[model samples]
Target: MRPRRFGARTGETQLRSEEYRLLRDLISERLGLFFGPELRSSLERRLRERLGVRGLDSFADYYQLLAYGAAGHEEWDEAAELLTTHETYFFREDYQLRAFQQEILPLLAKKERKRMQIWSAGCSTGEEAYTIAMLILDSGLFEPLADWEIRVHGSDLSKRCIAAARRGIYGGASFRATADVARGRWFVPSLVEEGKSGVSASVRSLCHFAQMNLLDDERTNLVGKCDVIFCRNVVLYFDAAARKRVIDMFYERLVPGGVLLLGHAESLLNVSTAFELLHLKEDLVYRKPLASTAKP
Candidate 1:
């Protein structure tokens, strides 16, 4: 492998040949994430900050420090942060939210058991989970079932994102797609002390954010069962086998008749046989059929 060179004018340093290989192997082995040569420059740029923070001059030394050092855990976290992409916004796919509000919520409202539980798996920055809460609040169906539990749990692989979600403070950029009525109903503007605008209190209370890695069985089990699971774009990064494993695990974690919403670009077609395709009039969702209805 040739060491990719970075021109000095770019103000970024390139990883040495050995350094790139070691980082690539570490990423693959630890997170099951892979990056090709095309990603070399981007990876190097992201890792450069970590190098500067740790005062390391070379990637080999940084790798060794990450692999074996007092700050090994911190290095592990930093590596994960660098590798994981957190590109999410409020109500990213409006069609899915509409389907949930118009179709799913009505069905749940009519049910004898009115409690609703939703999991925003791979929920980065708490936007998706909060969006679900807003939809539920807007639907006007929860009043009759005020006693019923309405839990929205948001989990992500990155602790940084989890923390951001927990803080419930988003800049103006996160609200661009949100409607004015929804914003007023769900969020309250706070004083932006540091040259940044803020969100409201209603949005903050709608979600519980926790640090979680989808690949960990123990963590997944702790989330228990939910009525809806939004795994979304998070799974596309994984290979087929990992994706299948994740879908199966989600199947067990959802109640019968619970819905699973995937990213628009994602499907269960070749990944798992555990879920049945559920075509709504407007959008397609997946359902974990009751045991009696599941095909043997």
Candidate 2:
């Protein structure tokens, strides 16, 4: 039986057990994500909006519409947008950036190619990706590697978030944590057109934004291999088994000796055996061991 919510005019419009089960099943099948019962209220609120859009009052009706209606494809996108969380900021975790600047960039500079590629997986609004760009540029690494291709790709499941990232406009609330020097160097203050401040063209051009669902194997394959993948604050939403599976996928996507950065709360200890955990003075990172290093 599902728990009931009291003190509501609508009574316990709480998602029924069967509805919860169906939602979990559908989301897992479509996106490899499982939402526990604790997220019932959030799921209910999001689904309620979809139901209202269709003028349907029951979960069963909404499910049927999603399953059999011709517009089911559109509904799938709407559901993804509703459920995908997009909480991120410029240099949200400073320690990881410090390690990249002091450690990773210097190592890459000695490599024959002198090129570096980074992917900001689940990048919410381009802040993290742009933050990486600033770090690389500020470290004085770009000049020597000018001949090498420097690419930063930011991808998320939410099309809306991708659209916003592509626009590169942010409010003061988003910049509160940003350093004053970084703000002056990376962003040019613009007129309060439409009541919002804008960033400079230079910072905006550093990243390419795209809509990608991590669970889609083909979509993940399309991204190709990268040197550094920052998939922070994302896998905690999944179960243990799902987390392991996703971590394995990341391992395959990264080049040998490539780095993987996670959120402060996340770790690769039990989740993956393929990665060699590396502890820097400033941050914790993982590396996909080179073939020779992995061989017995």
Candidate 3:
């Protein structure tokens, strides 16, 4: 599709085809993200805010700043933040969490390994990562192994988001799905803001946050191996090719027999065959096969 001819309007600035194509391609290549032609209007509006921040007037100027400016990489970080921040709440997708706590935890606890590492890939604002920790603690499975090491790492592409996650603070909106019992047990009133709360130190101690582009293999490797991966709703914005690449990365990161949980709307139908389908009592999940047990 060709760029739409945009003349200056009263308040809204137009994003030409040239600039949009360049920016879109860069975002896709770097972050495995996509914004189709239909989203041009919305994308333009969102990016216009960035232009205002930089005191620029044209999308082409912003594109040049992102493309060749010495500060381009820095500018891209802000742009990435704007483009990627999504609405998320604590205890989202409860059914899947139930499967994790009641069904999966016992089986995993039975394993010979005393240490458990869970990666909340694309964990936005730390809710999901913190939620997972609460579930694990609530399960009361690690009590037997007093010395067991438990850590939950949350990674996101937005630096702002990672910062927020690290701070462990949340507003009222984040607690919409959270039950009162869980909230009372794990959170305390926030000193920094009114009508908000922060995750308790006990729960915060079990979680870590970092800014990362999931498609970057070098950075991703630093996450080490994990026993279970929760990559919910994050891949829905990716193109098919990007989806496959990220899925492959997840496969490499998970230990044999480790589980990979996707959002309820997401599935591996055409993504990959390497992971075996696992039907849990409450939900369906996927797992990597042990080398000795894998089929030819």
Could you give candidate 3's per-residue lDDT for residues 128-157 as a string of tens digits? 999999998888998853578889999988
Q: Candidate 3: give the clashing pairs.
A: none
TM-score-wise, the better of 1 and 2 is 2
List candidate 2 segments past 4 Å from native: 1-14, 191-195, 292-296
Query: Going through the candidates in order, what is the number of backbone clashes in each?
Result: 2, 0, 0
lDDT of 1 by residue, 54-166 (tens): 99988888888877889987787777887777888888899988999999988888767766779999898888888888888778888844566778999987899998887
- Candidate 1 backbone collisions, by pair: 187-200, 188-200
Candidate 3 accuracy as TM-score: 0.91
Ranking by TM-score: 3, 2, 1
lDDT of 2 by residue, 1-296 (tens): 01122221256345677987887777766655667766677777777778878888788777787778888888888888777667778878888889988998888767787667789988887788888888877888667444767788998877888888887878776786798888888886556546455666655656888988777788888878889999988887766666777788888889889899988888876776778889888988999897734521
Off by over 4 Å in 3: 1-12, 292-296
Global Cα lDDT for candidate 1: 0.78
TM-score of 2: 0.90
- On lDDT, the leading prediction is 3
